[model samples]
Target: MVKVLLILLVIYSFSYGKIITGNWSDPVTPIMADYVKRLIHKAETENAEAVILTIDTPGGLDTAMRDVIKTFMGTDIPVIVYVYPPGARAASAGAIITISADIAAMAPSTNIGSASPVQMGGRDIEETMKKKVINDMVAFVKGIAKDKGRNEEVIVKMVTESLNLTAEEAQKQKVIDVIAENINDLINKVDGKKIEKNGKEIVLNLKDREIKKVEKSLKEKILTILTNPTVAYLLLMIGFYGIFFELYNPGSLIPGILGTISLLLALYSLNIISINWLGLLLILAGILFFILEVVTPTFGALAISGVIAILFGSIILIDPDSPYGDIPLQIIIPVVLFSALFFISIAYLGLKAQRRKTPTGSEGMIGMIGKAETDIDPEGKVFVSGELWNAYSDEPIKKGEKVKVISMEGLQLKVERVKDGSKI
Candidate 1:
């Protein structure tokens, strides 16, 4: 009985070695970096055999990519970067991360490479800066390749020449360890692979291991939404519109509240994503020009310039090479046109309002025709603006006669007898 119990306990203890698995299907942002860090920490705490991250990205921010690579390389547990799904391609930063993994892998029909760095908007940097960036990226990839025992020459070519390769081609070049059909296949292929960690050999025994799938936490999901570039851009535009409307019609609680919230959120998003200072400045300047147009009535000159500034600003707001990519022109054009129309209409209405005569106050009394309540020789009371006021005129005026208010005086109105007086 004692021996049977001992044997059962041993079998139960060794039956399932756990492995952590998750998907990274979006651009690498600060939020994503924090997520990966949390996953790594979770895997470490759970004593998992390995972490299997399935990737499908067009690449992302340079700083974020480096942060992810550091997390992978710094961990004791073996980290596998699998370019999964048939149609997936690990380009740019994704390619570099793949080559940096303890076990780089891919699904059938997948491809990797194209690690060249570019500025925001997918444009190359200036020549001198381009060479520096290219050389730096080349060295970075080469070092990662060397450390992971991958083909350094080919990996360097991926940066310098933007070389890309299919799964079979990558395998032929010794760039990946396995071509997997799925997660299960990946596990089986690398089940017995040995990795060096902290000068010690750590063997993966991932066969039939319990797969612990990681899901984003609620906080992570919210942060993900907030960090999205498109969401950020929209928030910024909405913030501006809200604040502008609030200024145009003061005491509008809704616009002020929404504008403050949206502006804060947008600013937070900007902190996480790389942005162009010039683009942000241009956008602000555009809004200022719109306000000036309303205040000064520039005959649409400043309004036109505002439109142009905003258009260009929207085009270049996000970094050209950012993983999220530039804001689509389809969205930009409609937004720009609509915003221009909105502000222009407001400006026109403001100008019109200014031209309108006052309905109350001293200015309202000017040019008004009223009946003289008392006979006057340069001093008398006159009924004006529905009230009898102390009034005086240059010439004598009779009672029950019409008078025209020329101007206002302290507690009085300066008036003149109406020429060809009609009915009061």
Candidate 2:
């Protein structure tokens, strides 16, 4: 009677319960870590049968990644991390995460490994420090692998030698439990797998369970966009352009205000992206060079160099190994080309404006030719630039005689004779 009752209870629990799942597709940011932690917490609170995380990431910040691993370690629920879909990979921090899960599984066409930490953001680590970093990672991964009953030596190779493994090979080597083609298949394979989690052994009741996905909240969606490398890069460009336009044409309140707002937004992103000071300096230098090109004649030399500098700086701005560093080449190419064209256009326009006839102020009268409307020995009324003004000349001015404005004083134009309708 007790056995039948137990079986009936299990059936009831499977029939009317939630099987929680989450898809982590972004580079592992702190926010991503938080998201996963929340999902785990929610699952635990609701007495979920299991939590399946479908992960596809190129890796991300080390601190955030470790925090996620820590959360997995502390969670009472069985956390099954699956590297899913074809052609997907669990790389860098991702590899560690998969290995650390209570049950690590992968799809047929997926891969795992490549957890080696490369120098990002700045220059290469000093030799002594590099050894220390590698040792630390090796120790950390080895510990996780040991606890998870994964092959520690081979896992060490992932960090030391940057080794990668196909899903089939991984399953054969016991790195992953199974190579499931889909969630249903995965459930069948891992249905009764006993795993140790949260200081106790628990069975993953994957059979016939309802899969409930924890969708990202609106805040997380916005946060994801803000931390995106491409989005941040574009924001940075917008900020630069806005400020440049405002500076170029001062008192244009709209551009200045817009620039300030964009800059603040960009700065917020940069903070999240983790600013590399050297990279930031290089970007600033590039802008300075472009501004100097507009002010001084450098034959487009400064402009070209500035574009190159900005391109290189932006490339190195985010850590190369981090998710933020992987801005596509397609984006970089267009941005560089656009920046060069913009600077050249702005500089050309600025120089042209300098050479143009002045429209107002004392210097505006120079080279302006007009007809004298009233006769005078040294002063007269003259029409120039569509406006009549009092004028003076070293030479006598006569009525209806064409006069060339050579200078201006106190709203009066200094004139020279325009004999034969041409200034002599």
Q: Tell me the spans in candidate 2 whose CA falls farther than 4 Å from its real position.
A: 1-16, 121-126, 247-250, 272-424
What's the lDDT for residue 181 in model 1?
Answer: 97
If scored against the real structure, what TM-score would every candidate get?
Answer: 0.62, 0.60
- Summarize candidate 2's per-residue lDDT along 1-424 as a digit string, tens digits: 9999999999976656468999888877766786887788778767888889999888877888899899888878888999998788898889999999999999988999888786644245688888899999999998998899999888999989888999998988878888899888888999988998767988777787778889885445655787776777787787788789979996454454445445644665656434355356657766876787787746687777677667755654653325343356578778878888888888999999888877777776688778888885788788888899988888887788888887777887889888685332
Give per-candidate clash totals: 6, 0
Across 78-181, the per-residue lDDT of candidate 1 in tens digits comes to 89999989999899888888888899999989999888898854788899999999988988987887777788888888999899999999988989888999
Question: What is the lDDT of every predicted structure here?
Answer: 0.81, 0.78
Which residue segments of model 1 deviate by more than 4 Å? 1-16, 272-424
lDDT of 1: 0.81
Give the winner by lDDT. Answer: 1
Best by TM-score: 1
Worst 10 residues of 1 by lDDT: 272-281
